[model samples]
Structure formats: structure tokens, C-alpha cells
Target: MSVRTLPLVFINLGGEMLYILDQRLRAFNTSEDNSEKGVWSENDRKRVMNDIVGTLFSKSFMDELLKPQQLYSHRTMKTVLTRLAHTSIMRLNPASMDRLYELMIMAFKHQVFLCPRPKDLLLISYNHIDTIKEFVKDTPVVVNQVNETHRKIIEVYSSLSEGEFQLLRQTLLIFCQDMNIRVSLFLKIKIQNPNGRFAMTTAGPVPHGIDVPGLIRTFDSKGREVRRREFPNGGSYTSPIREGSFELHGDRVIRLGVNMYTADHPEETHTTKTPSVKPNDTPNLLAKEELNLLARLMGSVKAVNMPGAEPGFRINLFNTDQEEDEAGASAGAGESLFGVINIQAMQDEQVATELALIAGQFAEKEEESENQSANKGDELLAMMDDL
Candidate 1:
């Protein structure tokens, strides 16, 4: 017998048959491939997954997605059909047929993609069967929570339709499995109408670490942690406490750096109202009124989550004397900011054991030196005993 052409089967988590239709020919075929003949393995599956990602989320696709609402009626469905030509199974269901149509409509209608707030928080976890939570009354959806005092807002994320959600859930599972940061991460999600949603129906088991958003921490005006300003170092620095928080990374210590603007004299009224300076003129080019406003408005934007930067209350160094360095007119002063790190675990069992050993040594020394006991300083003895 000539090499038997492969017959392919498309199935979902529910064992439902998936088919690709060629309406013109009115023919259906489930072309099984050499996958059953040991050609497809874990690594091969990974390669296929990568190919799906590269093709679907390519830069060109993303750019088109940004303006997805534009009608694509003129463009022939040939391009889309060609991509789906990879699969073949004659027995397709109405769900499968409608699913394909729905996705196409979404792409043509500009509902294919979204840009979520706090960009990095891309995905969230939720029960697959969890029905959308509805409010008691049809109220306006508040996409983000704002803090009036600190002007901080909790990040809002995007939700997906059933089809897009399922696809993403599958793709992300593949993507995260091979990544170094394979730990499951929860994220915020926004819900929109389908192509409702899609996922592995009978395609076997659904992988972990992908879903819609669940219980999230809500923040109010008093909540300050979520609003830490990121400070970019090694560049020209602006003098606005509104300039936000300095970026602290790597193995560097957190230090306080402040500068005063002399030209800005809110304490002394300006004889003539100064015009706004060119942004290039100087970093500290605020008018006296603006300067006073900035100083008053510099309501310490503290970091909510970042360690060592939470006590991050803003200060106007201009009003206070600059703690000059050993070398006058140097870059800036570096004083360590305290209470940023949680070191409770640092005093572990080993630390307690070490302290006990030291105290024992001190007690023995005190006994050996009888005459020295007469000179036992209360402060030193108390310190040793405490240790």
C-alpha cells in the first residue's frame, strides 16, 4: 500500500469534534497525520505552540489590532482561511462554525485586543464556570480606583471574551511552562462580549495559571502604596516632589537626595509675575506661585509595595538646609532611609542561638574576673544580658 495519507482529528477538552469546512467543495475529511506514528512529542508540541504565538501575536497583528474596529469587508477571507487550513476534520458542530465566524467578526470590528492599565499585570485567575458578577443596579463601571489626596489609582486590567480568553489561557500555559518564572501569577481581567470565549473543550486537560480576575485589593484616597512614583536615575533630575519616587533597583542602598530652588521664593512675594520658563531653560523653573503650589502639593507619594521606599514622604529640600557632603558642591547627599525593609525573619533560630552563646561567654568572663566584677558597669552588663 502506498504511504497512507494521515487523518487528523480536532477535539477539545469535552471530546467535541472540531472541523474545517470548505463550503465550495462540500467535502469533509479528518486528515490524520504522523502524530499518531510517534512524530509528535513534547518538544514538537512546544514548537507548534511557539509557532502559534509568533503568528498570532506578531508585531503586524498587534498594530492591526490597535485599530481593530476598522471594517475588513474588502479583504478576502483567503488569508484567514489559509491559516485555519492547518487543521482538517469533517464533522464540525454549530458551536465550532459560529466560533470561527465570531472571531473573524471581532478582528474586523476592532475588538481583537486591548491595552490594560499597569501594562505588566496582563492576566488574572478565576473559576472557569464563574458567572459574571452583576451589580444590584446597573451602575457605571469604574475602571480604576482613585485616591484624591495622593492622586493614586489602583491599576485596572482587561477581560476577554470566551473565545479569546480560552485561546489566551492555552497559549499562556504553553508560554509560562517553559519560562523561568513559571510560578502561577494572578492578574486583573476585563470582560467583553465574545467571540465570547474559547479554550480546550475536549483537547485534553486545561493547563494552570490562566483565567479571569478574582478578589482584588481595593484602594481608596488614603491608600498610598499603589501610587509610588518611579524615579529614573542617571539622567537629568527635575525638582518636583511631584517628580515622584526615585527608581531603586539592584543591590544599591536607598539614600535621600534633595535640592533647593533659590529663585523660587514663595516666602518673599515677587515684585513682577515671572513668565513660565522654557522647559529647557532649567529643571527648577517654576514661578513663585507654582513653587509654593508644588511644595504644598508634594503630599509624600509613598511606595505601597516596593521595599525600603514606603516611608517615602515627599520633602522640599529647598526649604531645609542641604546636608552637604565631605566634598562641597558634590553630586548629592546620601542618607539611608529606614523602615523600608522587613527583616523579621533575619532574627531566626540561629541568631537566637548565637545570642545565647555570647551571653554564656559574658557570664563566664564575669565569674573568672572577681575583682573586675566590682567595676561591672550596669549599662554594659545590661546589654550583655539582653544579648
Candidate 2:
């Protein structure tokens, strides 16, 4: 496996997470019932964005992450992201968090699979960084943190050989192998087949630095071109447009990692539990030593909790709390293959005990609204059923 693949995976997945959160936060802010709960104001949105982005691109964390190392196991990575998402006052219950992570993995997997060239992975990462910068434009410190990491990305990846890039891409593909969870957005756009694999189009422009198919050239013994011929190719193709800028600031040309969520085209975060095929039964278990190392790297950043007077609310990825509960129940029974990895009990007791402790750091806050009044809960349930 390529040592360089981990950064791309983390950055792209983090970007997708931000996109989903931003959309959901906006929806909450505009809801008519927002006033009943604490209103999700513009200031609240900015605080959440600033806190999460700052933690994600913090200098200490990024420094450790940039070092060459093996890719993290799925559980370890999920644990790390769980910590990151809870850095702000926002919270996710077990079920909502599982759905949120599934959406993130599948979204990034789609982008990597459709990338035109292995080298274009850098462009995709840059697109994410650029959009992240936009999210925290008002905070100079957070913007600088993002900028510093962007420069580090360029310094490390810009000079890599083509073969190295190919290896990096292959490593990513292996990580996402068999992760065919169905996403509603992808299905609506017709880019994903009913069975969960993405559909590739043959009519787009060829990858940069590549010649369109249908030309044949014959060379002589003296190493000179002797004959040239053209044949009818079945598909239409065109020359690639200009290469995207690899610098810290510019258009990224390709749109793979850019934020697809917007006010005009809103998207809900829903995913099916069943995959197209049964995933591998064997688990990719994490060793105790590796878990300790990851804990050390992540231990420095603590998730902030709201004061007693300030209220924290949960963000549900499903349409309603009842839907989230049902999904969580199925997953608890090991019936759902989240991100193609079965959430089985770890064989190593030490590792399992340690991960539980780490997870407790971001445990969901109590839903005060639910406990406040039974009549309110009934009214909400009645409203949802009516809808």
C-alpha cells in the first residue's frame, strides 16, 4: 500500500462531512419550528463551522497526519472522525452518526472512482481545501490553519512520479472496495446503478496528457514514423481542457471534490442499510498497539461541551427520530454492513475496552426537549406521522 494515500482519504472524507453538516445546519436555521427549540442563528452556524474546521486543520494534528504511515483501519478512522464531529456543540446519536459516516464514505468513494487520472487526486483534494477555506473566511486564524495545510499538501505531493500516483490511487480503491451502500442523491442523478456500483460515461473528454483513441502510427526500423492511420472509434471524445492550477489559490478545473450541496439544490442525508452484495464476513480488526498510537495522536484535541445554561441539540441524519432509531436497531444486530465493514465485536479485549473509552469523549448529549414534556413529544410524533 502507498504511504501517501492516507492524507487524501482523510481530506476528502472530511470535506464530504462538512458539506452534509452545512446543509443540515442551514435547513435547521430556516425551519419554522426553530424558534420553539433554540433558534439556529447565523452566529451558531459560524461557531460550529469555525470550531470543526479549526480542529480538523489544527497544526499539531496535521503534522502528525502528514508523516508516512499505513492507512488506518475502518474502526480506528471512524473513531477519530467521531471525535472530530463532536468538537463543536453539535452532537450525533449512535444511529445518526452511523448514517452520517456511511454518506461520507460512499460520497468520497464515488469521487475517487470517477477521477479521470491518478494525478488528478491532488486537484480533488485542493477543491476540498478551497471550499473549506470559504467556510471559515471570516476567521483569520482558521483560514491560516487551512492555508498552512494546503501548502504542506503541495510540497509533499507535487513532485510524486506517475507510478507513485497510480499506487496511491490503487491503495484508495482497495480501502473503498465492496463499499456499495446505496445513496439517494447518487440514485436521483442516475450516476449509480441499482446494484450500487457507479456508472462511468464514455463520452467525456479524455484525461489530460492523453490522446483520444482511434489513431495508429507505425514506426520504421530507423525509429522514424512510417505510416499513420485513423479508425472509427465507437464513442465520441474530445481533447481535455486546460490543466487546473495546483497552487494555493485558483480554480480547480474539475468539480469532483467541490461541495455539491446548495440552497437551491438541497439534499437529505439518507442511505439504505442493505448493500448490493454481501460484504466479506471477516473483520479487519485493529491491534492494541495501533489503537494506542491513534489515541496519542488524537488525545491532544478535546471536544468542547456546552455550559450548563447553554443547550445542545442532536442532529438527526434521518427524516425523523423514529427512523433513526430503527436504523440503529438493525445495525446493532449486525444486519447492516456500514461502509462495507461489519461492526463486529473485536477479538482483542484490550483494544475494545480502549476504543470504548475514546468514544465516550464524544457521547451524545441528553435530549432535554424530549424530557421536558410528554405532550410536546406526542404533538411532534403526531405531526411527523401526518407528514
Candidate 3:
């Protein structure tokens, strides 16, 4: 279990969430039929994007997240993401949230399984970060935050050895193990089989820095190549492409973490749940100290509602209320059991004390920042008057 696994998991899943939300929001705001047009506006969509991205890359939260730590359990991660999603005004009901989570996990699981080499995981994460930067491109503050975090990611993970990357990939595979929900888009593209597993293609360019299969070379005792032989390897392959850029800016050279949802393929968002897709009912025995740390990290997320904010509206993942109801009805027992935590129920005195301290500090920081922004605005207005 690599300590580096949590950042990748959070980032990829967050990227997936942004993709789904962007599609759903676009559908509502720009549908040709006009029936869904009034529900979401361009401003509303921007606000949701800004709020979620800001909170996700918040200095406090990212500072905590980038530290060395064990990967969180699936349930704990789900709960954290649920909170992250609601950091904006957009709301997801229990059923819609469940479906959204299913789509996110399955999509990322496919990406992970199809990754050519373990070290390429960094490329995949770069793909996600690139797209995320695009999402908040208009917001310079958030873009700067993302850029800073990008540098941090490169600084931390770039120095890791290949074996460490391999371990990280294995840890991610374990995290995604047994998630087999069938997605319509993958099935439509023939990339996923009927039973939900992604079909691995044996015919393609091999990973960067790897030679194509079917060649064997014999070396003499003096380390000179004595003979070369070729064998039928059952698969056709080609030379690998140039390695992807690992810097803050360049092509990631892979599409695994890129947004797949588009207006042209709204039907692709549909997911077919199977009986084997049962939720993990076993309780996560996460340590109390870790839970406290998570609570503090998440406590820094800004409140969704503002004093002069517009009225909030819900964003449903399904096309209609009926589908949402059916999904809710079909959800397995114990699926919702661990979706949230009751902080009040924690009996640990230390946890409560730490949470209170974090809350107070966050409140004070927010207030001071608001004051600084207000003063800056006043100064800008005065400068314009002088002009």
C-alpha cells in the first residue's frame, strides 16, 4: 500500500465527478428540446464549478491530502466525496448520488486496468489535472491554486522509483477490485464486455520505453549479441510513441482521465446495475485518529450558501424522476448505511476538541480573507476614480 495512492484516487475521482456534472449541467442548460433549459443557467454552472474546484484544491485540504498517509477505505472516500459534491449549491439525492458514484468508479477502474505501464499512472493523473485546469480556466485564483498543486504533485511523485509506482498501481487496483458496474458508453464503444469487464486489446503500440513482443536475442559470454530470433506472439504490435510530458504543461498523451461525457452522447451516461454489484457491507475499521484528521481536513471546505447567493437547485443524474425512483428502489441494502458520518456520535473527546479548533480557525481565516478582498475592491474603485 503506497502512501501516494490517496492523491491519485481523489484526483481521478474528482475529475470524473467534474465530467459527469459538466455533462448533466450542460444538458439542462443547453438542451435543444428546451424542456430542461430553464433549470440550469451558465452562471449557475460556473458557480458550481468554481465552488467545487476551490474547495477541492483549498490550501488547507490539499496540504493535508498531500501528506504521507494510508489510503482511505471505500466508504470513507465515498462519504468525503459526497461532502465535496455538496460543497456547491447543486444537490444530488441519495439515489442519484449512488448512480453518480457508480459511474465514476467504473469509469476510473477501466482506465486503471487499461493503463499500459505502472509509471504511466502519473501521465493519467496529469491528464486529469489538465482537464481540471480547463474547467476553471476563467477563474485565475482557482487556476493558480491548481497550478500550485500541480507543482506539488510533480515534486512529490516524480522522484519515486519505478517499483514505488508499481506498488501504487497495485494499490489502486485493489481499491477498484470487484467494481463491475456496466456503463453504456463503454459498451457502445465495444471497450467493455457484456459482463462489465473492460476488454483488453492485445493489438496496439506497446507502452513507452518497451519494445514490441516476439523478439529474442542471444548474448555471448562477452556480452555481445550472438543471435536474434523471432517468434509468433499471436498479437500484432507497433513501436511505442514518444513518452508523454511530465512537466506542469504539455500533452499527457493518454485519454484515460479525459472527460468522456459530451452533449452528443447523453444516452451514454446510463448505467446498468447488476446483482453482483452489491455494496461492501463490512464496516471499515479506520482508526479514530485518521477519522479525526479527515474531519479536520474536510472542515475547511467553505459553506455552499452565501448571504446574497441565488436560490439553490438540484441536479439529477438521471433523465427523469421515474428513473431516479427506480434506481433508489433497486439500491442494495446497506449501501446507504455508511454514506455519511454523524460527528456528534463520536465518543472520542480528542476528535471533538480538534474539530472545534479547526472550525474556529477556518471561520477566522475566512473572515480575514473576506475583509482583504473587500479592501482590494475599494482600492480598485478608488484607482478608477483617479483615472
Candidate 4:
């Protein structure tokens, strides 16, 4: 009896081949030691493989490949590739080795690993290796590759020693945060997986890591880890303060000297409550200085501060109206800017004094004239009585 051969296939295109990732499934099988429930069997895998082969050879797929989106930056290219890696539509062309190489080079060049895991494959690219080698100048390529598995692998190689592990982690975190923001634009739907592992079943639309409420609870339940130490010059440090300072969450004012503690602390301490401000008081003195900015906009400050004018210097001018019946009072002059501002409005005392003096002189002259007229009228009346 002749033995039937189950065609053994290895699409050896350095990291771009994801659709036919039977090898990853095999690795998972070896590690898990149990077949995932609902997982495709060997026969199903063969069928899917045949479907993939069909699409790769099809003219439609080739058209789409030729009409790739025009992307400006390496970051944008990475986003495009990451989306493609997650998509199930693209059929893997096993025979087109050149095309496969092109895809792999594109993926590796752009740090596509920062994206979510590719389905059915554990992809690693040569570009990542080159990047790692460049980052750790004196390290061997093998060591750089292994370092991904064990991040602290730098300690093992004296030639590749870095200044501090914490610094590297911080740099990596900042880099990832920035890249993630850029990548988020392309992610039409967020795919979540707990622990980045599937226990024989894919959790659809699930987020990676613990849920928000659970994470909050876990943090609340954790014990308070206090860090207190004595520094030189009788200085003391507390974990909460250090944590806040390290995180750069407090006021940014620079203090000059040792008495800086008093300078640095807000009026109210040991509470999250913002200190109550007086109706006009400002917490930031520099903010109060900004009121002077209004002066600049309005023109000279000296014009705003001239001394008040005396009421005598002021004139109460009026409009005369024809007298009607006694039922209603005549309407005084309607408020006008000229009247409100020049006659009635407050002004310098010297200007007011001059105005009052002028009005008094006019009153005296009118009184003298009335007296002269009355004397003339009495003389005329006496002449008439004598006659």
C-alpha cells in the first residue's frame, strides 16, 4: 500500500506571509497541548489554503495590489500595512516570491509590529533586527533578536551596555504613545484580546487588558507603597511628593533658594480643593500683571487719573420748552453725551472751580441789571402819581 503525502507547505517570505500561518497554529498547539475549540481542522486548513492561492493568482487581487494607496510618510505606510495584515481578504501568493519579499520589506521598514497582532501568524521582520542592532551599536544581531524576548538582555552583553534600563523604557513608552496616536486614524474598528492569546476561541471586538472598572478596583485594592528617604542637607522625600514631582503634575514656577518650599506650596496644601480666591485676587501674580495690558489697549494711564473738577466749574445747561397746562412737568433735556459728559459728568477740581467762578460772576451782573430796571420803573410811577 502507498502512503498518501499531506503536502507540507512553508511560505518562506520573511514575515509578510500571515494568511497561511499553519506554522503559528502548530506552535500554539505545541505550547497549549490542546486544540482550540471551533478551530479549523487539517482538512479545513487545506481548503482555506486553496482559497488563498486562488485569490493571489486572480487578476482582481493583482489590480488592487497595483493600485496601493499613495502614502507620504513611513508612519502612514506602516498604518496601511498593519491594516492589510489584519485583513482576511488578501490571498497569500506562495509562488510569487518577489511580491512576497516586497510586502515583507514594506512591513519591516515601517515598524508594523507596533500594531495589533496579525491573525494566524507570528511575524518578525529583518528591519526590526537592523533597527535593534543600530540602537545597540556593539551588540551582536542574535543578541538583539533575543532581546525582544528578554528586554533586559542588554545586561548580559558588556559591549552593548546602556546607561539605564528605566530611561530606555521611558523613551519606548513616549515613542509608542506618539506612534499609537498616528496609527489610531487608520483603525476603523478596534480589536481587543485579553492577554494577546486565544484559548481555542477568538473574542470578537474585545479590548486588550483589564476593563476600566476592574482596573480601577485593582488599583484601589492595592496596598499603599510609601517611599520615604533622607537626603543630604536635612532634606526629606516622600513617595507621594516624589511621585507627583516625577510625574510633573504640580505648579511650574521656579523657586530661587532653600526657602523655596514655602514659595512652591500653594496657599492651601494637603487638599485637592483649589484655594478660594478673593473677588479680585489672583493665584498667579503674573496674571494680575496682565491687567496693565488693558492700559496698553486703551492708551495712556495718566489720562485716566486726572483730579476731579469742582461743581462750580461745571455748568448745568438746560433746554427750554413752552409751558403747557399744570398737570405735567416739562421734560428736562434728554440725556446727550455732550450734556452727560461736559456739564453733568465728574471731572478735575480745578476745571470745576473755574466753571463755578464764571457762573457766580454772571449771576451778580444779572442782579445789578434787575435793580437798575426796578429803580427806573419806580421813577416813572412817581411822575404819574404827581400828575
Candidate 5:
């Protein structure tokens, strides 16, 4: 038996027989001795059959492939089909027949190949019970482990008919949503739908949000350590504070980096109503106003979930001039707008363990030093005797 002459089976990824249409036919004009011509003729026939199968698989075979709805290039579809055709055992089934129709219709509409006669096509549109059972055994549908959001989406798709599934899949592709999430919800969606990048970039299995107080403590300890190391002499280099807090409650916008833009006294007095600023200028003015409003709203709260540089909160470096021994030395000088703090956002589980360890060391060391300093010579001698 020749490899070229062997009966070819057309199967989907699930190993279901879509249909058995035509035998590999040779061109009447080609000689068997002309290997190039014979090979060419055989390849051409296989390609046509592949296109027919691809069209049947698409949503509206005709509309999905031919109309503006089709996104893939005709050439791309050919490559996809050629690859799919490599699988063994085409199982006949209601699902397979339905998919074949979609693929064929799409291919025909796209003019990927000349449409074949129904007679020439030899449509084997019967359900292969054995193949169906095997397919069910071998290819069970599974939801991707990372995408929980898609689990809900698939439930909605389960009620849809095959045609509806195809249409919905196409719609998801057009709208630029996660097809994996969509497909996991609906088993009928193709296994080959492009792997979704949105999920890869944005979604993770980590808990949704973070802890506020814990995060602040972490940043504070870290900042203090860094500051102590850097400024062993105390010139007060300002480091970053918590920028703002996005909590389970809601995000709080911080206002810092303020630049005063009040009119000069003479300009204000002469104010012949400065030609009512144009709408084009309104956006910048509005942005400045909003920043100021945010500053006022957040300014003197004893504590917020987190703190850091905000748009309106400028870090001004005003100095105290009291011969280095002023009674209100800290109070006289401008306070660090972000406060004397550095806060890190606390992520979950593993991070919590790390933070706890570091914090424990610092607390323990401080306690040890304080105890040692409090005990004088006799107390130290007594403690040493007990040891």
C-alpha cells in the first residue's frame, strides 16, 4: 500500500470524525511517472479538503469567513487546517457534523478554494457512536487554573447551541476580551482560540487587595533603618512616604507637590475680571483646583490608611533658627509633609511572614538596649549573678 494511496481520516482535536468526503484523486492530465506533477496534484486535493473542513468549523462558515467578520487571513486559516488535519481518527458525531458544516461554510464564503459539489464531497454525516464514546473518554474539557473570572462566563455559554457558541466565540474575539475565560465557560469554544494575553498580564491567584496598617509599619521600619544608615549624622534627607492608600474601602488620593499660583496683590487689585479664562484653559485650572481640594480633604487627618506624596502636598524644606537648641525645634521647622514615615503596601501570606521576622528583630533589639540602659552597676551585677 502506498502512503499517498492510504485512506486519510479527518478528525478534530478531540479525535471526533468530522466527515469522510473524498478519496485523494489524481489529475487526469498528470502521468504517474511525472513525480512532481503527481505530488502537486495530490497536495492540491488534500489542501482543498482541509479548507472545506476549516470552513465547517468557523461560526457562520459563510459569514464568518467571507464577510468583514473574519479577522484571520485566508492564508493563516489554511495553515491552521493543514496542521489540524494531521490528527488521527475522525469520529462521526452530531457535534462533529455540526462543526464540519461551520468549517465548510466559512471556507466557501472566504473563497479559500473552489466549492466542491455535494456529490463530490461525499459527506459522511452519520454519528460514529464508538468514536463519540472514545472522544468523551480522551478529551475532557478543563478550566484553566489561573482564571476564576472565566468560570462564571462559561455557565452562561453552556445553554447555547453549537451555532450560538460559534457566534459568541467570534464576538468575544472581536470585542477583545479573554477568550480563555470565555472558552472555559463554554466547552464548544475551539481549543485553538489564541491564548489570552490579558489574563497573563493582569490576573494572578493572589488575594485581591492589601493590608493598610501593616503596610505602613513595614514602610516605616524600612525607611527608619535606611535613614539611620544614610544620615548617621542627621542632616534629614527626606525619603518617600506612602503615596496613597488603595484599600478594601476605596482609594484615597494624596495631594502634594503643590505650586502656589495665586494672583499678585497688584494683579488681584487691578482684576478687571481677567477676560474669563477660555474653556481650553479650564482643564489645567480644574486639575490644580482638584489637587488643592484633595489636599484640604486629606491634610490634617491624624491617620489615613497609608500616606505618601500626593499632587498638592509639597515637601518644603523650611529651617528652624534657634541656635540648635530651640524649645520647639521640630515644631518650628516645617514637618515632613508625608510625615516621618515610610510605608510599604503589605501583600499577602509569604510577605507577611517576612515583615513579621524583620519587625520582631528590631523590637527585640530595642527592648534589649532599653533594659540594659535602665539597669545600673548593682542591677547589672544582680542580673549577671542570676544568669
Candidate 6:
């Protein structure tokens, strides 16, 4: 997948693929899995995403966009990672951490995992004056809020490795705690199964781990074990697997990067959550839907930073209009699960201060060079006068 440019603004792409997805979903609904509770496959990630989108964007939502609607980095994703931990995710494509660390070590740079070229930082925010004026100063209420925020942060902080701990403290925290933020931390996970096997079967009411022959172990979105019963001594040893990511939208978590198929009615009906089609739903929608459907046929997935990530994290899903309203109150200027970033939404003073500092450094260097030039000029004048 092309690693699209960063500073990706979240926008909905509509059209024919939406219809294809709708159609594919209809087929899936009638599939055998729907009739019974089956062990989740890597494909379950798609189901999770469909469930999430369907839940969020009800039939008429686009005409009436959901409350607290915000943009996504990109709805289209390449890979869905099944196993993740509390670590920094570069907006850029996945790269070797060891290699980046080596480069940083050689350069004697403190931030090991940061985008090496500072200019590559699509957007960086300095703290707003309010951080000092409104948040950090002696106001009792603000002070309490600051402490509460920091306290929660520290909890996540403790669970990290030394390198990650430093990165969070130095880089991610400054952006996350206040409105002047830049990035968010991410927790990756895998498919979940209670039993250690991947091919599982339930002979009776209870789900059981089968030991037929060659079974694999896996995890789910929340990192619970994906137990499976052993496959019969099969011809081919490998089963092609799929992957996914648990995407964060504000405080709510949804699954994304799901190349799965569950159909939506191309045309909206009042009976279900399938969103109403608008004129803008373009032709390319078919390609989009087919791609996702193919991924589902293929199946896999992968968090939040609530720390203590030994076994896995616990996730709870609930949506209420009242909660969304409350969310608006707390959401940052550009809130993200990776980290809260203020983006360029900072106060003028912060920006000016940064520019001033850069200008000052250049001015000092220029002055020093001019002084050297003047000294050389005087020496040449003395030589000429002597001649």
C-alpha cells in the first residue's frame, strides 16, 4: 500500500464501493456464520469495523452527520496489525526501530523514535500560553485538572519500557496533556481466543479447544487468545491469515483497516442502520467495497494506553447521545487516540515565540560573521596603506 502523505485530514470518501460493500454485507448476513456464534477469525476484524461504522453512521447520518463527528487520518488502510503493545506509532510507514535508534544514537539525539528530519514533522505545536496562563498557574481548579491528567498519564508511563517511557515523557506527553498536543500513544493487539488453539469447535453448549492435528494459536482485537481445534492432517500446512487495527475516534474505539465484507443496502431502507445514499456517492465505491470484501474473505487484526499490558487490555463499548455531548466538552482541539495534538490550533503567542527564537539565532550568527568580515577589511586597509 502506498504510504500516503502525512498530516492526513480525515474525510469520508463516498460512492459505488459503498454499494458493493452493501451488497457484500447482504451475502454475509445469510452466510452460515450468522446463524451461530462462531469463533472469531482474523476476518472478524472486518465484522468489527462494519459493526463500528454501522453503529456510528446510521442510515440518515450523512444527511444528518452524527454528533461530535470528526475526521480520520485515513479510512483506507494497508495492513491491520493483530499484535500491538504500548508504543509510539509513526504516522509514516512502519520502519525498523533498531535502525532509527542507531541513527539517533550516532547523532546523539535524545528522541530516538522521532521523525529524524525535524522538517518531516508535518506539524509540531508549542505549548499554548494558556498552558501556563490557564492550566499550570495557581488557579485551584486548573491545577487540580492538570494533576488529574498527569496522574492518568503517569499510570500509562509506568507500563512502558525505558525507551518508550522517555519518548512518552519528553515528546508525546507535552502534546497529550493539554490542547497544545502533537501525537497520541497506541496499543496494538491480536485476535482473541480463550483456548491456545486457532481452529476451535464447540461440540456442545461450551466452546472447546480441539486437538485434531495442527492448530495454531492467535489473538483478537483485544488480544484475547484465539483458540482453534487442530486441523486434520491437511495437505497444505499454511492458512493465509489477515490483519487489522483498532482505530480510535475521539474517546470511542472502532475497528479499521478491515478488508471485510458485510453488505449494506445500496439504497437505504428505513428498517436498518445502512446509511442513506446521497448523490455524491461516486462510482469508485464498487472498487472500495470489493477490496474490503476481499480482505474479509482473506481474515486478521490488532489499542489503548490504559497500561498494565501484561495479559491484555480490557475494552468496553458504549455510545449515548449524552456521552457524546459530554465528550465535546473534554475533546481537545485535535484529539486522537495516538496522542492529543493541538496541531496548528495554538495561540499566536506560541507561534510568534518560536519564529522569534529562530530569527534570533540567525541574527546572532549573521552578526558574528559581519564582525569577522570587518576585521579582515581593516587588516587589508592597513596593508594597502603600508604599501
Off by over 4 Å in 6: 1-318, 332-387
Q: Which parts of model 1 are misplaced by more than 4 Å?
A: 1-35, 71-387
| lDDT score of residue 72 within candidate 6 | 16
The stretch of ten residues in a row with the least summed lDDT in candidate 5 is 1-10
**Superior candidate under TM-score, 1 versus 3:** 3
- Residue-by-residue lDDT tens digits, candidate 6, 1-387: 111111111111111122222333343343434343422222432433333233222222222222222211111212111111011111111222111111211111112112222221211111111122221243354344334433433343245454543432344323212211111111111111222111212221111222233567778999999775655554422321222112223454422211122223212210111122222223344335544543453232222223653222112111233543443443332123334447675579988899999999987885565444333323322222222
- TM-score to native of every candidate shown: 0.17, 0.76, 0.75, 0.18, 0.16, 0.16
Go through the candidates in order and give the C-alpha RMSD of each one to the true structure. 33.4, 13.0, 11.7, 39.3, 36.7, 29.0
What tens-digit string does per-residue lDDT give for candidate 2 at 267-307?
54767755454444444232344445445544432233425
Error of 3 at 25 (Å): 0.4
How well does candidate 1 score on lDDT at residue 239? 33
* Superior by lDDT: candidate 1 or candidate 5: 5
Model 4 spans with C-alpha error above 4 angstroms:
1-20, 28-36, 67-69, 72-107, 110-387
Alpha-carbon local distance difference test for all models: 0.23, 0.72, 0.74, 0.26, 0.26, 0.27
In candidate 3, what residue range of length 10 has the lowest lDDT sum?
A: 245-254
- The better candidate by TM-score, 1 or 2, is 2
The full ranking of all candidates by lDDT, starting with the best, is 3, 2, 6, 4, 5, 1
Best candidate per lDDT, number? 3
Summarize candidate 3's per-residue lDDT along 270-376 as a digit string, tens digits.
88865564446443333333445445544533343557765457888888989888778756544564476556454789988898999999878855654443333
1 against 3, candidate with superior lDDT: 3
Instruction: Give the candidate number with the greatest TM-score.
Output: 2
Model 4 poorest ten-residue lDDT run: 1-10
Q: Of the candidates numbered 2 and 4, which has the greater lDDT value? A: 2
- In each prediction, how many residue pairs overlap at the backbone (N, C-alpha, C within less than 3 A)? 36, 0, 0, 14, 32, 54
> How much is the lDDT of residue 255 in candidate 5?
16
